[model samples]
Target: MSPDLKTSIVASLESAAAKAGLNLVSVTQGTGFNGQPTAVFELGLPRQESLGRSLNLELSDTFDFDKPDLLPEMTAHLAGEAKRLRNPRPDSYVTLGGLPLAFRKFQWPFHRSTSGADTYIVHGEIRLEDGREHGLHAKISASVTLTFAEIVPAMEQPYAETFIYNAVRKTVDMGQLEFLKSGNRQPVPVTTRYYSRWQKKFLFTETDDNERLRYLLSKVYWLSGVLGGSKPVWIADPRDSQYLNTGEADLLRMAGHEAGEGLMVLDGEFAAATPALMARAAEYQAMLEAALDFTKPKFNESMRSGQANM
Candidate 1:
């Protein structure tokens, strides 16, 4: 990408973020592994309010605007994305001690030379100063990508009537389903496309720790409904997935502890792509669990020694 174009795109994005009351933490221009022009936009909640918990929204886009006319179009494309980032849908599972479980989307933006209209995600995050006060003092994060085109048409069908029967018959054959329900827990709810509610508004819920599971179950119910349609699928592959840390990971590290539990669901395409990948991830999960067990005793000891000195 030319320096002039890069400068223009950044300026356009910064302007949009400012107008939306968002802090444009950083923006970088580069090329993707596929050699396509790429840019990453990192945004955060305004700094005026200081809360222990935080939210960061990152967007990655790949474009090709080699022609003169397309050069100017790049700015418009980015501006549209910036607008999306300023708003996102509500899909909360569980909120933690001082932080809420953050939801993010792995939207890979690409260019289409064809004539039809294409739907894209307008991705961003909302911060509630103490939204996490209700759940365990840990981080629980998940990502899902829903397409507008895929979901609107399927809203009237009996989701459970069809999905439950199919899932029961196919559960054993579907490796991803088995993996998602690993601990005898219900399958992870992920949707391919959702009717974009967060695209315009954000609802705030302030509660204590007692309602943790209520929030989780509600989120799960929502996920099951949204993810039941045909075009929208749950993301299950770990490789293409991204995780968000709203200070929980850092807090755990600072206190000589680590996340005891977490989950990452892959989109259907990747999840169903191969059996070998799932097996490998399962193996890695086992190793990680063992490591966490070894570290827990040390963490406990450190806490005990600190308390003794106090």
Candidate 2:
């Protein structure tokens, strides 16, 4: 990229970051693992430089600097990322069924699968974050099919994070992933099946209005009531709206209904679980238990027949 283009991109990103309460400390150009030119964006919270994160962008393949709309689109993407990073646990998420998991240690800039498979893979781990010390988690290798990879603009952190995270969550929801105290890295295939070319979007799970409402309540109950010391949690996260096949305004509307029902208190786009919601703790606990059970490996007739020998 030309120096002028780089400068313009950096300036736009910095402005967006500042508006979103993040400091864009620096933007450095480097070579990515795929041998492509990459831009590394270092960001920090205001007055807390020690707590910082790096977001990577692949420049050559992902953007066309000559396009008039490129800068604005990039700026909008950065702003959305900044909002997600402002959350108490940006890497943490709650499943629709109430299982809270924190995704971490992801090896980014997706690599060609070494297993000779026609896919790109990123390795990561997800730990159960239900405000308990059970230490249950899973190591995973998320693989993107070559066909599916075509639709992804870039394999870098900024572009692929939300969809990959949602794929993992969806895998768990489908009972295809097992969390254990220890285990080898299991596979989570991300294929074109998760995307709708017609809709031009990714769909993790099909949820109705009732399911959406329950998901919002469960998110507040766990993220705020259980883990966040009763602080309000952002309810209308764009990442979530994308994952749930809904819009931010719809999420806010659901939050408003939740407030009316005394299930939570809404402060703009943030919400905290109310006592009325907490009173149904047993119900939430049961949901988590059921979700956990669903994720466990079930034995087939043949496996069960051989269990006695084992």
List, residue by residue over 74-181, the lDDT tens digit for candidate 1: 333333333223222222322221122233332223222132434222212222222224322111111222342243222111111122122221221222222111
Per-residue lDDT of model 2, residues 20-50, tens digit only: 6677767777665456665666676676532
Off by over 4 Å in 2: 1-16, 19-21, 25-41, 48-73, 300-310
Residue 215 miss distance in model 2 (angstroms): 0.4
Each candidate structure's TM-score, on Cα atoms with residue i matched to residue i, is: 0.30, 0.83
Q: What is the C-alpha RMSD of each candidate to the true structure, in Å?
A: 20.3, 4.0
Worst 10 residues of 1 by lDDT: 237-246
Q: What Cα-based lDDT does every candidate model obtain? A: 0.30, 0.79
Candidate 1 regions exceeding 4 Å error are 30-35, 50-107, 110-310
